[model samples]
Target: MSADPTLQVSVLLPVYNAGRYLPEALESILAQENICFECVAVDDGSTDDTADILNDFARRDARLRVLSRPNTGIVGALNDGLALCRAPYIARMDADDIARPARLARQAAYLDTHADCVGVGSWVDYLDPEGEHIWTWKMSANPAQIEHDLLEGGIGGLVHPAMMLRADAIRAVGGYQAECKDIEDYDLFLRLLEQGHFSVLPEPLLGYRQHPASINATSNRGARTAIANRLMAEARQQRGLPEKVLTPTPATPESSQLEWIDLALLDGNWRSARKTTCRLFRSVPLKTAPWQALGKLIQAALGKLRIRAGRIRQFVSIF
Candidate 1:
């Protein structure tokens, strides 16, 4: 048995014609401090200079292992890397994203402290190609909360690139399901949540690069929708949850619009929320839509109050 109690996480990076961003991503992973990790770069037969980049990195560092295979999609490449990983933990990093230097070390420590957490991730900063900050994505810390929020919309709160999984637990879930090809990470996360809890560091651990040529930009929306449906069904079955539990509550147009207003309020986005609420109140007929219209007005007022309170708190804290 390896004497080191700290799990040696194998960083799995699947490269497919990612010559531009591969070097920086690999460099950041290798620069992690106070941690022992194996960087496995699986090149899925890139027609560009991706192979050369991988080869150069492999030759320079013993920790960097290159697996060159014929052209396969991201799902296949990830599965292949997982099979060859010898570590007890697996950390996934996208070829196009930049992982912070402390990402592995922090997640490793979190897992070590929390035995119940089978997987861990952190907030991600979305950046344009020129490295301009777009927005901050904050994920739910509570497992139940995350799952509940996911039912209403996307569960991609914990970005895939910043995710680290327990090797055995992942295998137990049958690895990534083939049916969820493009949305593989989403499917795996839902399954992982069913078996064990998740932890988010509450800080940006990865810089997600967004560009026009990115795969997600041109991905088949119809295929992803199909995969999402299957994922929901599997999660429900595995968790022994009732179909009604997963089913989204049918909301009237006014009521549904109110929900969006509520979300904006909670996130401190007041102007947009108030504007939307005002529009709904003016356009919607009061007698027929009394409950919804009233609810929107109440929520909108509360949103303004919340914003005022937040500003007051900030001002006091500064003093």
Candidate 2:
């Protein structure tokens, strides 16, 4: 399809079973100001109300274009959406994340002035499932630093959903790679870095939601780490640099127990959380880093307190 001469940006939103957060995500895009854009929302065979929501939104707004297909994972959904994008710039978005109103405007403006930059991302306010602010995730704005980090097997300031990519530059790199899977964004950023310099806006422009149902939470961490290590090795080899010995961090039983405890707290299962915490505490003495275990336990307790306090505030506000 030919590029739309009138549109300045194309919001590429690939959605799965994200019915709970889809409306907010769509509203964020539709509500963006000072930028002419089209939202190409691809529904990857969502069994939930995702398709219905998309259809209703599309009927109300012409800019939101809905495309439905079989469940083909994120990489396939992204590439397919990439093909349908009608603007020179493609802004990536997730169905569960909320973009700030000025996100598209500022990003589009930055790209307009920085001709050397092939892609740009911004810092994001990390949000919990209930839309509560967790913390601001800051990314380095320096291209040199970003490249260095990528070479060292880090993400290099390119937060996937918070990025605005040059359509041509992304296409040149062949979009998202299927082999990369869970680490697809990291791989794409590495390849995109070769085409032109990447930049990051220092300010937070998106609300990045982290929940149990998120891909990162559900994916195999070991496999992702292995893929990332391999990509870094390949990148170093291409640059004629010495290969760094990278090892995937092994998941300890204590860490798994802590995660369960955290989830239990989130779900208001105090009894289960107490039981798991006790088990974890017992196992900690056998481990090498006793202090680290204690620190983690304290952190988990603090998180639980925060969640409870937030719920209390919400309940109070209701009256």
Supply candidate 1's per-residue lDDT for 37.
Answer: 88
Task: Give the TM-scores of the predictions, in the order they appear.
Answer: 0.74, 0.81
Residue 302 in candidate 2 has what lDDT? 90
RMSD of each: 9.1, 8.8
Per-candidate total of colliding backbone pairs: 0, 0
Question: What's the true lDDT of residue 203 in model 1?
Answer: 91
lDDT of each: 0.76, 0.86
Model 2 regions more than 4 Å off: 250-319
Candidate 2 lDDT over residue span 1-319, tens digit each: 6999999999999999999999999999999999999999999999999999999999999999999999999999999999999999999999999999999999999999999999999998766666765457687999999999989998887899999999999999898999998899999988987899899999999998866556665667788888898899989999998988566655554555455555555555555555555554565666644445446557767987899999999999999
Candidate 2's TM-score? 0.81
Worst 10 contiguous positions by lDDT, candidate 2: 288-297
Off by over 4 Å in 1: 1-7, 151-153, 237-319
